[model samples]
Target: MSGATGAAPSDNPQDGERGELSIPSRRPRRLRTTPAMRNFTAETDLNPRSFVLPMFVADGIAEPKPISSLPGVVQHTTDSLLRAVEEALAAGVGSIDLFGVPQEQTKDALGSAGIDPHGVLNRALADVRQRFGDDIVLMADTCLDEFTDHGHCGVLGQDRYGNQIVDNDATLTQYADMAVAQARAGAHVVSPSGMMDGQVRVIREALDAAGYADVSIMAYSAKYASAFYGPFREAVGSSLVGDRKTYQQDPRNRRESLLETELDVAEGADFVMVKPAMPYLDVLREVAAASPVPVAAYQVSGEYAMISAAAANGWIDGDAAILESLTSIRRAGADIVLTYWATHAAKLLRQGR
Candidate 1:
């Protein structure tokens, strides 16, 4: 008898009487034989409910302004922002993380507009709540940089030596006030992205004191001072002249992320996040492992711009790249992902792509 490949039968009886080869015991490829099989065996699935869209709402704009560096993203006017939120809801995005870009005139050293009940951010929160009515989660960015003239995340002060620096304790006070304002304005979650120490605790206490104990806090626990935030600065019209290394985590450190996660969790963060997700998946994994609460990762502006630029130049499949990048972040154990592609990715997931 011949084998299935039509090989001639072995002449010697000792050479496997039927001229058959031994079958391998292990065949991992069997599970990957088809799309259905692959889908069934996927360890990490990207769910639409796990996506959070980061939106920029320019306070005084009459129309949406495109961000040049971050292609396909824009600084939205209030009306435009509401439309975008509606679109996101239709596309099944789980939440919208709002960042307000007040006009330059509204900025001040203290970023007092951030705590004003009628500030752009707070009004946007009110508008979304009125429109959506709990149909989708509304998250507010509780930070001072977007509202401050100096573009630092906190108030500035001088040490006894007269060296200027961000005042962490002062920043915490601002964050607490901002949290209360956001909660009052109907934010389901207030994400403190200033990277200030003890911020989560202060915000938590403030929310509790204000009878908003239900409002969640998502701490930017391991936000690295990365170059990836360049486009974000532009998108928010930041006037920052110097780096945030004094506060934001150093990109070179690994174990430090775990420590930050531990601190945020201890400080009563409902969720902890890692910024610039792609560049810091290792940190995300470590933080996710150590965090008792949900872990989120922000796919920052640079990551989006890089992928968008490459796709425009015909260097990569844009859709595939976006999906792959998000999948990688999810695989790294991010419970939620804040990405510009949240709406598009959610639609694709609905289509089972």
Candidate 2:
């Protein structure tokens, strides 16, 4: 048989009729053909300055203690914390958020250590300020959960029916006091993560009254009561028994987040944020769209642990996943991202650029 006689017809009927090949006129692939082209055409660009590193400083620790669930993360001693801050500064991270881990024996019902001048968080703030002197934006987690033995984020009381409940007004008083304490300790920002109603207004008033008008309040405006916070409990050494569904936003509701965001913005939150960023990207997008203030998203402990664990198992490209996750949050409208991988991600972004 002759080869030409057995040849197949053109896949396109028109091509066979005209004896011509079909080609696409518009080629989006041209833009993606080269790495340089992809970088130039990139819609969302990440910068190290947009990352905020969340750190833990433990009181009365002779050495840094590793949190098993958090893998590379640890509860730093005062000495180690200063070193870590140096690394973060060198990495060009935008900020560092400090969480105090009081010794178990020191925890109490009222979480008084949070307001004490010599409190672990306050002392860590002072030390970081004395060393860095505003080289970085220092933020304090102004919540009572880590310091309170009961592990609720606020003061507790009994309802008329004899059920224990977090007293909203009383907790606001404690939060106001805590904000002032954090301000005095050299925090540039006091972040109220307790998800209390009217917390932003109360904290703002207290900070201004204490001559800390310059201190900014970053409200945990749309924090959801998520199980994604599992590793955070370990990171902060929390004593929580029950869930915080009573105070934190319900994961199923989006409208409530917008309302909370609006209230926080009206009350003087310099920044408002959505917690457990990956799980609440939709909420973050809506909040970012409606709020006039800057919006932040937190890649919480569980999110980090999942990625880290998978990476360890050789199931995913760790660096790529980290960047992708961060980019997703940024694309969803977060001006800042509070993440455990902040320093590492900062370095990754620099290397990539």
lDDT of each: 0.92, 0.93
Q: What's the CA RMSD for each of the models?
A: 3.8, 3.2
- Give residue 208's error in model 1 in angstroms: 0.5
Candidate 1: what lDDT? 0.92
Task: Give TM per candidate.
Answer: 0.93, 0.94
Q: Once model 1 is optimally superposed onto the true structure by TM-score, how far is the C-alpha of residue 39 displaced, in angstroms?
A: 0.8
Candidate 1 displacement at residue 10 in angstroms: 19
lDDT of 1 at 292: 89
Task: Candidate 1: give the clashing pairs.
Answer: none
**Total backbone collisions, model 1:** 0
Mind giving the per-residue lDDT tens digits that candidate 2 earns over 20-137?
7667777788899899999999999888799999999998789999999999999999999999999988999989999999989989999999999899999999999999988999
Best prediction by lDDT:
2
| Residue 39 local lDDT, model 2 | 94
lDDT of 1 by residue, 292-331 (tens): 8999999999999999999999999999999999999999
